[model samples]
Target: MKTGEKVVLAYSGGLDTSVIIPWLKEKYDCEIIAVCIDVGQGEETHAIKKKAISSGASKVYVEDVVEEFVTDYIYPTLKAGAIYEGKYLLGTSFARPLMAKKLVEIAHQEGANVIAHGCTGKGNDQVRFEVSIKALDPSIKIIAPWRIWEIKSREEEITYALKKGIPISITKEKIYSVDKNIWHISHEGGNLENPWNEPKPELFDMVTPPEKAPDVAEYVSIEFEKGIPVKINGEELSPVELIKKANEIASIYGVGIADIVENRLVGMKSRGVYETPGGTLLYTAHKELESLVLDKETLRFKDIVAQKYADLVYNGLWFSQLKESLDAFVDETQKVVTGVVKLKLYKGNIIIAGLSSPYSLYNEELATFGEDKIYDQKDAEGFINLFGLPLKMRAYQMKHFVENQKYNKTTVGGEQ
Candidate 1:
């Protein structure tokens, strides 16, 4: 690549990305266009722009992608009932593709051949960012400073930043690696790296302590249209808006706190403390809705697909065709899942308040235990007889064969 070619750097106003802007400029002697995709980072974007400029970037592109992040990425996973390995909601996984896409866009716009991110060599973010970039624009030269550069650790990077006179936002004392988005905020590293250590309560941003949650139960209604959340408290919203609204409501109830030890794609178990209060609430409500609308066989079959779907999303195969096909199946099943789920949130528990669906298959009179002429009690006798026909026939044949071994269907030890 040309030495002076423009490059788009994925910039967070944090220590790693802040230091990366100047590092990119000096190492390659190229124009650095810092691209920050706002996936609900919950801060003023302009400040990040200023930070990027001070760190030696020629330009800054802070794109508002919360809507896209929620609708295209978060909502689809919600509809699929995707929880990675039945625990993780994949807060960080969902944001990476959208950010990488934006990076590719800015790189092409700047006529830049190179793109870089602050993802560490040891983490999953590098895989997420690089895979997405290669999938979107394979021609773009990927520069991963963490993988190649001599910055051995975060401490070294901090010292480098100080020596270069670059203003850094992170401190040595508070060094928990964090990724924030509208869906959730995840905390890893530091004390959390050890499974024996309980997550620090102060690490939470979106939730109150479950113990501090309301003593009395709080109720809320969510309306779904074809398995997708469309209305919250009767206010219609886009997918993104619905999740954001849910996030606000659920956070108040101290919902969506997940501390999991999960296996990474690179084959190592890692621990993360996650806060996805809205996602937690949404997941519970949607499953309840499906239980009402779906038949027993369909629900069981969908579960098998759900596992695969979860794997696909977690493994960053969102753009794959298999995921598309599974999504189609999920969408078709969701046609009858249009309804409202009222949930009673008390402490850390989500109790079902009520559920009503337009396509509800509940036949109360038939299911009732009361005596009815239409339902014959003796009918079970014949039904059970038919159901056990094969077993009965085998038993009868064996009984006769055992009794008359010499006249058996086949000679026993040549005795016939």
Candidate 2:
């Protein structure tokens, strides 16, 4: 609460962050440095900039980290096949850490000792932002307004914003907490909090309803080089462009609409709807390619690793040593994950048409039921005997034990 001290705030032109500019000034009596990282929100940054300054930010920084987000964070997660709780694709999970890291970098650059974010303490993002800041620069102080401020609800925050003369887009009636980026868009709050209520089709932004999707199926080919997506439909594209193209195509077929009521890291359960058209496509294609390239044992083991990796990401441990170690293992497995996967899309389904890789271990000739010179049918006898040896031994012992019990009972009865 020192006057003249500078605090860098992560400002997302939304109601919470827009109100934060005034809140920080009033609470700390410090100069506010509002920073907005462009992770492909598709909204006008110029408007966001003007709004921040008018709301009392001394300076505003709009950083474009879309490419970095896709290549460094999204691709790595996709390659790991990390789907949290078997449903959520972790759209908002990874975005938080990246944004928090940027906040730290900007704080250092601007010579600000304190960093502030608009994340609420009840949610996972608060942890994601704070933990990432701690990992990057432990000395930097974090000011989470939601944890300390008296504003309890969105309605209360709106009232505060109105009283402060701050410009905001949220209304009391149509308030839906949303987070958008290049990868996906997440919708929380509103009627989505109720698990029994199905997500109305109109609630979705990036995807159409499956009932409204095109009648005919669509096919697309995705190419991967060393686990990173490179091309779409035979044309090589940059990471950003590839995802953009995929998003465009998949959205048409109403792909990637997930409604999950997941357990939060803060020991609470929350429901949210995620629209990840491009991310779903990329994840599906990457998995298909890995299935072709990786051996059976390695693929199954990697699945186990994938679950742990999802946990680390969902819990906001991106900059930790364990994450780096897992990344090394994931990267090692992806060395041979080079190939193209063709998929057929109909409504909300992504069906694999074909998959091929130079390092593929699937030998069609050996796997066929017809005669094959490479695989000898006679060799199966020894293989089966060795494989079932323990089971066979146990069965033999049980049979002998039963026979001995019958013989002992007969001998005792005859003697009597």
Candidate 3:
């Protein structure tokens, strides 16, 4: 509430955050501490500090949290098999909480009482950022300029940035709001706003078009230890390296491109095209491994948990008790999920080649169609009868009621 107060801003070196730097300084007469927590934005992060300084930031912190992002955020979500709307892999959804946590840490270290983020009023990121911030440190105040600022549109924001002499990469003609991280890159806005319009070829960044992919299918083996991917094609890799390698391989095959029209947390439907080449590969391989290791009942229940977990992450409840509890259950289910899964990737198709796990529950003798089972075939008659008992009783009751109605109708007309 006071002028000249120190405020920590979540600076992405993007259009919104770049404009926010001078805007916050002009409005509050405060010192702006720009914090860009790097979760694999790649080359764009190289000049973030310099950009922040030029945009009137007193100090800048470009923290590299890629490893933490992969091991903590990405892996847990993957292990739970959480996918939003049965399609989205939740690339942008889970990243916001981690960014909020980093912002709070930087704010505490700098003795700042206020935090600012460039998340627009209409989007879900505003809720994700503010809710996580409140959950972590309720006392710190939040400043969301998109909701309060006089500028009404992206055009206005661009004009303001240009007038202030802030360097930016976005232009109106080529404006597509993009969010990029190690997990995926998402494209929204621009022509993508119209659901009827198909995304142009140039809209894709990470993935090759499926039609343009090679005719030959490529085989890759992914190994998992306790549901976490450890190796690809027999090479043991660090978490970051594994994802990067997966991205490299899968992108070539046009894998992991999702065009979704999903319900936003703020009660609106939005369309986005997501490029998650590596994430798709991991999710597919991990699921195949789970199918091998997990039992019928446990797998069914875990699927229910997966939907709820996806909701929690997508709705910005990453630090909540329910999410923690779900993680515990997922971890328990993943105990026997160590295995290797071979997949054939060809032009956006992930075909399961083979799967092997140390704790596999697939009994070959029982499941085999060629005779020689450890059970008798005649036992199925009793099992089927028991399973259909309720249906049989219901059918008998309906038949009796229909016969009684016919007799009553006949007796009403004449003596029986």
Candidate 4:
């Protein structure tokens, strides 16, 4: 709260965070260090430093955690096969903890006592940022301006920024809360609030419209080692390059697009349009490879674990003990998940062309219906009887009971 105190802000160079610089300066009268964690925002990070300084930050630090994000956060969620509400790829969910982690690191590096974020009071990100900070460093204080600031809406924030001479890029006409990373781009607010309204063409940046995609189906082959994507079309790539290439290819065919009304952690149903071109492809490839290697029971149980994993990530409990334990189980399943999956991308539909694994459970010899040396036709007789023993006893009991009732029927008056 003192003038000389240092505070590290989770800066995005967006309207909210851009305004937050001066707001913090005026409110707390503290020296602000704007920390922008670049998780593959592409060109969005170009003017971040200049913008932060212009908005009243004493210093700016832009940290690129793209490779760490993909390997640490994205791949773990992918290996667990977690999809929120059966559709959401959790583009915004998983990115929060990693970003918050970086904010804490920067806060410590800057020797700042307080870490600040621009997440609004109504959204899940506030919880995501705060909980993650608490998990890593409990002694560090957090300043959330959205809960304390008098500004009520985006328009109000813009007006406040203009009045304070804080330079910002957002205008009333182009107002949409966007969160972008290596994995996906999420669009919320604006016309997206109305679920019935179709997403405007201009809203689409990462993925094209499905109808506008090429008529010819494009095939892509992905190779996985220990459940992490190792190659694309037989070419090895780094963690960052793999996601980048997959995004490029899948976006061309409009491969990933989901418009859903998801239940937010704030107890409200919020409609969001997500474009996870690369992530969708990777999830499909990884899952297909798992099917080939993992047995039925393990896959089925993993499906249940996947749902819970999704909830933990979505709810911002990524650092919890339960999630760590689930990761252990998920990693055990991925040990044999090394394989290659070929997929056909056509108008946003990912069709599995082929799948193969060294540990594949698909054995043609034992599965053949025709005469096989490994299996005896007569062996099915005893196996079927044993498997259906309960059903056979129940049928016999019902038959005998019906026959006895027919011969010795008792009426309500006790007549037989």
Candidate 5:
């Protein structure tokens, strides 16, 4: 509704968003509130409030939502076993809706009709942020500066910010856009844009490349409660603390570096180098524990079901029923998926060191190759007989038909 005389913009104090603050101010002629949801983008957030005020924002809110981002968004995706296309952990995809939800809440609180973001038209984030806002509150108009504004490239945005004296951290010499939280740090643009180009040392944030990783292997034991990691190395911790602990541990061993040429929700190809050291270890640990406790059918079906789950979250369908239903099913599976998994982090590879669960179905006696009392040999004969009964009957009918045809031919000759 246009009744609201104010507008709230999701601000990162970056080049795009810094320019967008003033642009929205001039275009809408309304009071602009810059809402910066802090989901753990560290040092860059230092002067965001000061910068937003200087850039013509009437007010600024630098809210800390890091714990909620991890517990609510990140952990649930981990619970549902939703890994985007087997490589991506859905880093940027998961962060957007939480950001948008906060934006809508702030907008309503401030009596604002317009909610805005600096997400580019080329990527999936615009769809994610806008769709979520519409799902939550459709009345608010979305002001996307990237889609509507004349200023095209980051270079131009930086130049504009420099000329206008807007405070920003990025310069032309260092051009990688890094999005960081407890979950991951994704590097895009610059050298990563070319699909074949290998990322240089400086492109990475928290991970050492496999080749340069320590020569010795690092071992870790992670404890889980209903598929959510509860502790690292026998020490209990909260969600944020666990991730923080794992990030430190995994980074040292060169864990969780993904370079992918992925298909965007906008129907374009893009390359991004992602470092999610702790998350990579967590996923492996959870899956290892799951493989032991979860039945063959549930695990197999859930693996396939998770693709849809990933798509829903990746495409911003977190508020939908199907995702909730999948969560219900996934939650049921995780009830018995409680335990510890040991992993060997060597260079880039995460080798399964060991896995143990209270409800593990891996019965050594039942699965052993040698003769075992638990599994009677006579059971197989009955099972094979029952299983092959239909095939045996069909074969008998075909043979009998041919034999009767020969007898009939002999009988016809005798009658003639």
Candidate 6:
């Protein structure tokens, strides 16, 4: 906590981070090393560096982490089928750990023991960032401005920025806090605070409105290898390029938009609108492929794992042992989940058109409605009897007990 010590900050060149650069200098009198981990938010690196330096940062590092994010964070979560609260695709949740890891790496490189972030005390990112940093390096000091700083409310922060002569694009009227990456974009705050308020059309960035989507349904085929999307419409692409292509195609037809009132890790309910164009397509295709290949029991158990995995990611326990174990389970299940799934995208609907896989467990001979050599119709009679034995026995026991009660009542009445 000494003055003039180098402190690495997780910078975004946004309003909160822009203000933090000067505030850190004024309060701690420490040298601020601004590090922006780019996870495909589409930020201009040169502009961010310029702004960071202008705002009193001694040095700047804009680390490009898009490819690592997709292959490491996103694909694993996708393969696990982890959807937070059945709606959030975990766009912001999974991105934070990677960003924090990069921050810690830079902090080590700079020989700084302290790290800072722009995450607020009220939201989930603070937990995500701090926890991941602690997990990575327990010795790094974390400075969370929102928890300790006196300047509260975005309005007050704006005033402080003006007083400090810092450049910020956010205004009081358009104060929606947004988080964007290649996987998804999330919009919170502003009027979205109210659950009943319909999200304004202008708030959406990645997806077209379902009503505004094209009249013609477009068919797209996605091929997967071991549960990771590898191709689109018969064309092979790198992980990053595949996601971009999926986003481009699915966004046009308004594929992935989720408005959710979810339970935050901080014991509060929050409303957020998420746009995950390509992610939606990928998730749908991967699930269909799993259905084609995985057995009923493994698929059912994976659903359980999916919910727990989603909770761990949402609660910022990405480095926890349970999550690592679950990842192993998910990976084992995905070994046979290689296939091509064709889907029809129209007006925000993803309907399965066709599914093909060499590892498919679905057998037409056993499942056929007409004549089938492998399956005997009479076999179901014995199977049903075995499957429903407990129910049948319980029903019979109830019937006999009722008749015995009636007989006992009649005998008692006659004796009276």
- CA lDDT for candidate 6: 0.95
Off by over 4 Å in 1: 372-378, 390-416
> What lDDT score belongs to each candidate, Candidate 1 first?
0.86, 0.92, 0.95, 0.92, 0.87, 0.95
lDDT of 5 at 341: 91
TM-scores of the candidates are 0.92, 0.97, 0.98, 0.96, 0.92, 0.98
lDDT per residue (tens digit) for residues 278-354 in model 6: 99999999998999999899999999999999999999999999999999999999999898999999999999999
For residues 190-217, write the lDDT of model 5, one tens digit per residue. Answer: 8778888888987778888778889999
lDDT of 4 at 395: 99
Off by over 4 Å in 5: 1-4, 44-46, 388-416
Model 4, residue 62: what's the lDDT? 86
Write model 2 residue lDDT over 1-416, tens digit each, in one string. Answer: 46889999999999999998888888778999999989899879899899999999999999999999998899999999999998889988999899998999989999989999999989999999899999999999888999899999999999999999988889998888999998899999988878898987778889988899999999999989999999999999989999899999999998998888898999999998999998898899998888888888999999999999999999999999999999999999999999999999999999999998888889999899898899888898999999999999999999999999999999999999
Q: After best superposition, candidate 4 residue 277: deviation in angstroms?
A: 0.7
Residue pairs whose backbone atoms clash in candidate 6:
none
Model 1, residue 279: distance off in Å is 0.7
Q: After superposing candidate 3, which stretches have Cα over 4 Å from the reference?
A: 44-46
Error of 5 at 247 (Å): 1.0
Residue 168 displacement in candidate 3 (angstroms): 0.7
Between candidates 2 and 6, the TM-score winner: 6
Off by over 4 Å in 4: 44-46, 397-416
- What is the model-wide C-alpha lDDT for candidate 1? 0.86
Q: Residue 15 in model 5: shift from native, Å? A: 1.3
**Which ten-residue region of model 5 has the weakest summed lDDT?**
1-10
* lDDT by residue (tens digit), candidate 4, 1-416: 66779999999988899889888888778899998988888745558898898888899998888888998999999999999998899888898999989988888888898999999999999999999999999999999999998999999998998898877677888889999888899999998899889999889999988999999999999999999999999999999999999999999998999998999899999999999999999999998898889899999999999999999999999999999999999999999999899999999999999998988998888899777798887999999999999999999999999988876665534762
